[model samples]
Target: MSKTILEDAIQEELSFFLQAIHECVHTDFNCNRVLNNAVANIISSVVSGKRFEYTDPLFVKFMKCLDENIRNIGTANVLNVLPIVRYLPGDLFKFKQTLRNISMIDKEIIRPFIEDNRNNYDDSNVTNFTSAYIKAIQQRRQEGQNTNMSDGNLETCLRDLFIAGSETTATVLRWGLVYFLNYPDVQEKCFQEILENVGQSRRPSMKDKTSLPYVEATVTEILRCADIIPSSLPHSVPHDVEFRGYTFPEGITVLPMLSSALHDPDLWGDPRNFRPDRFLDTEGKFQKMNEHIPFSLGHRACLGEALARMELFLFTTSMIQEFEFRPVDGVSPSLQGLPGIVYRPQQFNMKAIPRAK
Candidate 1:
């Protein structure tokens, strides 16, 4: 998808999200649902060539299922190590529910979309991810070049795009709010930068990213502190390899612990602190760090890194520009995270008091 399309999707959904927040002004509210809704639509727009309204019943139900699975998957993940546990008489670890969730999602949401795209498959009309994948499979079949690519793979890849795309990006924004509540000074700095560069008269865009170093640095710092997927998805060694006197056998599972690099004290002297200045250089410019790998590194890194980064900057800057995130009763939320496929922030509530435009 073109950056313009993605940006436009975000800008439109952002208005709805801000309006949702506006309704809850001065009242403590958790932004989890609204955030997931907005992020999901943005991703769906790119992947499916459509975006669902936040109030759409089917879309709302799909999001609920997705959220439930995300929460339960941490416990259900044990099924991978102890497959026998899944045979237990009940959904103790929520493994069954997770499977059911995926099935329902495919049946009600993803499958219909894929089928529609397949029936109306067009090479020239390949505008979105789903259409593009379908066209690839069609071309391969015409050339009689059969391989692993199939409809199942296309469905699975689409699922990955939605699940991984929405959950991680939304979770990071949740963490950003947590930090904002904890450190209003940092939030104020970010807003001041946005106000100076983009101004209150208009929303911040990717174009403003270059001029607003503090806002960029703040988002960078959020990703660093959030470290949503601390241990990235499991990777397999292509071949036997030796590094630092350690031999990695071919096809062995390797869980790259991103937290090691993200939170390494050696990389940042005060890595534990919520300091955005760490991402800013001596000249107050946003500085990229090689060790800062919240999205992991190399070929296996998160596929939606660019989209995720764009969402973070636009959502965060827009939020900071519109409102002041303040803690409830002057009490900040816990910094503790619930461990899962994606490290999620503890459930917390805050107020998004609108700033003077």
Candidate 2:
């Protein structure tokens, strides 16, 4: 959809997200679930012209399933290489369960949502992404032009929007919090940038992005360092190819190790360090590097890249303005992340200390 639509969605849901944190904040608080719900609501807002209350049953189930599928992806992907193992029985790889998860999501969430959008198609006012797609299909049919905008494709797009859009963005946010816990100085620096540029009276917006170079750099660095979707989605070998003294057979699954590019030593001399300044130029302005590919590069890159960038900046700055993420008992969080479909931080506890005005 359009950038304005996504921006509006984030701006609207951000209040609820901050409120959820306020209620849940304590000596030991895990904001993961609430973060997921908030991001999902943004997707819901864009997809169906609706947003779910954090406590709603469907909203809860929706967040749970999205998380479950992400948790399952690492294990389920193994069946891709050893297809025969599925016949051996049991949900060892969770491949069957992953299928079941998708079915559940489609039945309980996606199908009903898409059907509702179709049943209530509004041509005069195409608000959300689904309605907009329906409008396009209708226009195509009226013009007597065949189009691939079928219901099945619409369903797949909706699925991609929900799963990839929500999970990756939310996971990156979580990783950012973990990093903040580990590097409070960097966290404070970001907060200072927001405080100085946007101020306490106003919320940080996309307009503040260019003015807050340090904050922007921190977000960019988080995306680069987290590199959550390191291998990206698996792709089949298009043809026999030769690499550095190695050959791959056609049809073999190639997990492009995206981390290699992101963590390349030549690009960042000290790639292992969590230094946001690496993204800043000598004049202290945020500058992007061609080697950075957290969303994966080329045609297979993420569809929600723009939306993801907006969410990252808005959520990161807003949260920092509201609270200082701290480790339990002043201890630092481990930077090592759990590798899966998305490389994410291991479950960790931290406190969100509200900042003084």
Stretches of candidate 2 above 4 Å error? 236-254
Name the best candidate (by lDDT). Answer: 1
Collision count of model 2: 0
Full-model lDDT for every candidate = 0.89, 0.87
Question: Could you tell me the TM-score of candidate 1?
Answer: 0.95
The number of clashing residue pairs in each candidate reads 0, 0
Residue range 270-319, candidate 2, lDDT tens digits: 88899999889899998988888887878878878999999999999999
Give TM-scores for every candidate, taking all chains together and pairing residue i with residue i.
0.95, 0.93
Per-residue lDDT for 268-317 in model 1, tens only? 88888999998888999989999999988999787788888999999999
The candidate maximizing TM-score is: 1
